[model samples]
Target: MNEPFVRSGNRHRPLSEARARAARFAGALQDLGIGHGDRYAIVMRNEISYLEANLGAAAIGAVPVPVNWHWTGTDLEHLLTDSGSKVAVVHSDLIPAVEAHMPPGMRIVEAGVPAEIREVYGLGDVPLTGRHPVMDDLIDQTEPAVATDQAPPLAVIYTSGTTGLAKGILRDPVRPEAVPGMMRSLSDLFGLQPGYTTVLPAPLYHSAPNINMISAAALGMNIIIMPRFDAEEFLRLVDRYHVDSVQMVPTMFVRMLRLPKEVRDKYDVSSLKSVVHAAAPCPPDVKRAMIDWFGPIVKEYYGGSEGGAWVQCTTEEWLAHPGTVGKPAGGAAIRILGPDRQELPVGETGVIYGRPADYWPDFTYLNDDAKRREIDGGDGFITVGDVGRVDEDGYLYLSDRLNDMVISGGVNIYPAEIEACLLRLEGVKDAAVFGIPDPEMGESLAAHVELVPGAKVTADDVRGHVQRSLARYKVPKVVVFEERLPREDTGKLFKRRLKEKYRPAEGNA
Candidate 1:
């Protein structure tokens, strides 16, 4: 625990150093009027300061709201305003874009862009707003505040906004006595332990990675924060650091699997003990390939930002129950409910709902209490609009989000099925399937495909490939090729953007 606990580029900071800085930051926050229960926004990529900001906010019982740096215009304004964030900690280089949208009276703290991040994104000569308080200077000038004994306030996490505007999930704060149980749940779910070296390549704005980072810090584990995800560099870091457990998403697995055999083989990833994934439904083929490559260490959990992981499966369990996300985890319960809100029998598709473990605090969508009541099953469970079924053995298998389901020609179609089939096609790097307006069928499936570099597949090739594997009705009526698909590093696709192109004009059908 005394060793350097966090690494970014060539810089390494130990947990003790981080704690001291966090305390100083807490004092600075108090001076700036951010107190217990007040929210502060963190707008940055994966970096040491991102971790520090979260820790500092938590030290004084304040909540940290991590904002996705990619958002702009209304999306950005909506989050800052909706969360009622009293302050925002932004990277100096990002000030130009963020400053314009920041709400009036919200304070700003600039975390200077590290060279590693600037280099990775190929940033050059980005100007900063010199008017804001610098994070380092604040820490230096402020006196360390006595850390609070109460458990930290739950962070205000926003949804991925794939369907619409992101909603802030404001969870109830954990009582001090409940801290140990919550920590144990987090440790078990994330495969973290004290002193275990790990690498974090996913963006910190996402819930899974953000939670992982916080838990890893609490356990005093050695941490390596990648500026951004680079398939080769990830392998190299694992080899160099002799890292143990690491969390990832299915998209990263796909990218690494696409690497040339020699390139993937060059790194000694044998040191990896656990490789965990979640955030989206992983295609079976991709999961099988990952298990084969990473040994039996590939594990997965199914949950959302609303509640902690409620279902999980180890590699062995997953192999036994191929597509299952696993039985209820950590004393949680799952139920698949049909249209009438009655629980469906095993093997029947319906909206997936779960009662999270008692250790997880209850939550409501900020400024949308009625929406929270809408999802409540009224039987002690809640759903996030996912569609799935459970096997006789009680293992859950995900189909797709309820919003993503398309009814065409009076037949229901789940885009995840077609997307998985498309991924199996040769040279297909990524694909997104969603419903689009159609006169005859009411709505037709549209597939947006991203091919591997040098791939020369035509729209016909894409459509024919789907036709060969899946039912004709599931094959997308409109096939469009793109250089790349709009997706989060966490594997959530923004299909709304793709579907917007097909929206009918106001006066026309």
Candidate 2:
């Protein structure tokens, strides 16, 4: 197939060209002594070459590990050493961040910063110091590597490290017989199909987008990638490309909704057939607005990097049950269990566990088998530490991560519910709720809010808003304003960072 993968702000790469480049990349890695089971890191932005590098590594049975381009210093060092990555394919601009901390003798392949990426980041077009090999030159000089029959393995996706250090989730190589089932599951969850045109606006380094891109390429879909997500530009791309589907997070929906009515009305997004969102729990109001604006195309799923199982919900299902994440996809099942590991009755809140349908592969935590054991609740059920409950109709409603729940006077408080309420208030751009020490209550809820540009809002305004919607105790005991909040590109808030900042010192009342 000669279908093209278009990178917004850059040129299109035909599938044939992409395949050839991937093969050459595989040949080059083989020349550098990379072999089966070896891991290499790709620390670049959202560019076509990022996918090419991944394909190349798979061609030779080597796994390509995608590093979050935003990581630096100790986090960067820890990932590189922990994964035992032998080579790093880095963008020209990001080399500076990796040079000081890269593992010894690690080969570096520098991808030149494309003008599009430079423009997005406001970087100047500058020459590299020639300390590392250029990716293009290597591809041009090497012949395509011979293909292997080995089943490709899943990429090692690291967790967000909210509770502690990031751990790589590794899966066994895909069984050849399981390929069809795996593809079907991915297509069902991501809305991917052959010959369809789709836009991927999230960062490629993110697990969902990375897997989606790989699936799109394999399916011969016309792929349009954005260097960075701009709310208006996304709408324009859908109209311009007649984009049929997309995968996004809730934050993108919020940003798009924040656009003026005229700006939102300017684009014709009727071409969208499937708009799937995951990675975070979307506010019910925000999701309802999107379904109204985009028709019933908006869908949602709940899963993790562990590759165990997934739960999905359609627009009609969501509208029917309003906050439910829908029922588990065919073959999958969800179980809510209390602290003692006994299954909880429907409508009772507890930890959520999932078991993959018959077709999915099992995974392990790289270098940390004990961690894997902890998540496994026996009988093939595993959880990522989320707290939620299933309704009478068997639809799941997420409360919050088990680690993020606050216990004040023996009452469990889910910050996500409060944050959702905070987002509904006018002038509130973003919010994070967590618990802090209190002498009397043992713990008290604290909120940090980011306001819309030039928005005039106060702590009392936020407290009153929450109080009107929820229990008085749910209203944050303390509210702080900020110009911005720490959020990952995928829309996950770094509440761990905020909690650490407000943690009371030992012995302090």
Candidate 3:
């Protein structure tokens, strides 16, 4: 029987057999035309096979490009075309939803379907072809137990370019030796003990969760997976499975905390050993509120989708620094540099940069190499265009993307700072800030907010909240309620989407 990684009504994959399955899947891919250095993209929800394919592809030197499952078919097509992917494997259930977006002449594979879609593998429920013509099946597979490959690179995850079209960040596979450092810091932050099972909460296609998943598998930790995020059900599932850890983004944390206190206490979550929060700047108030309820198990990580630029903080350090993203990890060098790429002194804001022991060889846009080399300083450093500052102790605090920073009447406003303050307001549940063209101020600030369920907070109330937390000039001129703010796969707020939807034309304004 297969170890069921997906836990809905059916959770069967035990931790023991997951590796065996990855080898089986790797062999399947090789037989399906995958080879060393080939590129294959996966666009699906959370499942064990996601990890299997990721590591499996790495083993064969085929690059795994995990596209955000929420993207429209057009969005996925961009990734498929941009990455020059040779083949694709998808969830049959989502096929109809994005089938029209698929490009012609692409080889396709499916795991779950109506049994009529020829050549389907009904993931978890059905088995693979027992014998295929692929070479020494076991040898062709990347050793499921070993993932670190400093050379050819692992996977290329695309950023949800809410500010622009998605840009891909290639990840170098981590080694068992590097696992100790990442796991030690992560375990210390999450309060984990030996033999804890962590649920892959965030989608594994993204960097943070992908790293956490592979490390968990190698460390012999049990793994559970969620197909997608559903707040109420997340709590129920946690209680039902007694999950110890999950890679989470702040977006989900706010929704879970907003659930009535009664609804929160409904589950027995004492088994939770740790929770990893990264891919966004979590608000200090949000962090504090969670500590009050869930204890000090939240671990904050500040790293780019690109290889460098990292800062991690634990719940305890977070309580002390409040907004700090902790000190560096992985023996990787971290720095704060000005626009000129010169190292900034403590207290000065600059672009955060990092050079991992092993970094992206050919960094930037896949088809657009010029755009890629633009961010690669060629000095062995990569900056994702985020502007930040380092304090005396080296804790990192982000302002916003260098280009996304808003200037109104000569004062610079960082959208993240405003968004953080917005999360604390009564009625506002989530917020995204962007700059819109303003005849008066060059570029004025605007916000799209998601309100707490049925809270009935109006635009004026939100205005008051922003006024209280920030400078008068920094307040948003527009505060529109959104059923949901557009977000990337990595849980980063898509300020680009908000700006496009609300910004007026140059003359229209």
Report the number of the highest-TM-score candidate: 1
Q: List the candidate numbers ranked by TM-score, top first.
A: 1, 2, 3
Q: List the residue pairs that clash in candidate 2.
A: none
lDDT of 3 at 200: 68
RMSD of each: 1.3, 1.6, 5.5
Which consecutive 10 residues in model 1 have the weakest lDDT in total? Answer: 122-131
Q: Please give the CA lDDT of all the candidate structures.
A: 0.89, 0.88, 0.69
| TM-scores for every predicted model | 0.98, 0.97, 0.83
The global Cα lDDT (0 to 1) of model 2 is 0.88
Q: Which ten residues in a row have the lowest lDDT in candidate 3?
A: 113-122
The CA-based lDDT of model 3 is what?
0.69
Give the per-residue lDDT digits (tens) of candidate 2, residues 1-509.
54566555757878778888999999999998888888899999987888789889778898888998888888898888888888999998889888988988898999988777888889888577599999999999999998888876788878877667789988888888888988998897888889888898999887889888989989888888898899999999999888988999998998899899999999999999999999988888889899889999898988788854378899999999999888988688899999999999989999999998777778899899999999998898999999999999999999999998999998989999999899889999899999998889988999999998989999999999999999998999999998889999788888877888876678973
lDDT of 3 by residue, 115-145 (tens): 2122222343433333222223443453443
TM-score attained by model 3:
0.83
How far off is residue 50 in model 3, in Å? 2.8
In Å, residue 100's CA in model 2 sits off its true spot by 1.3
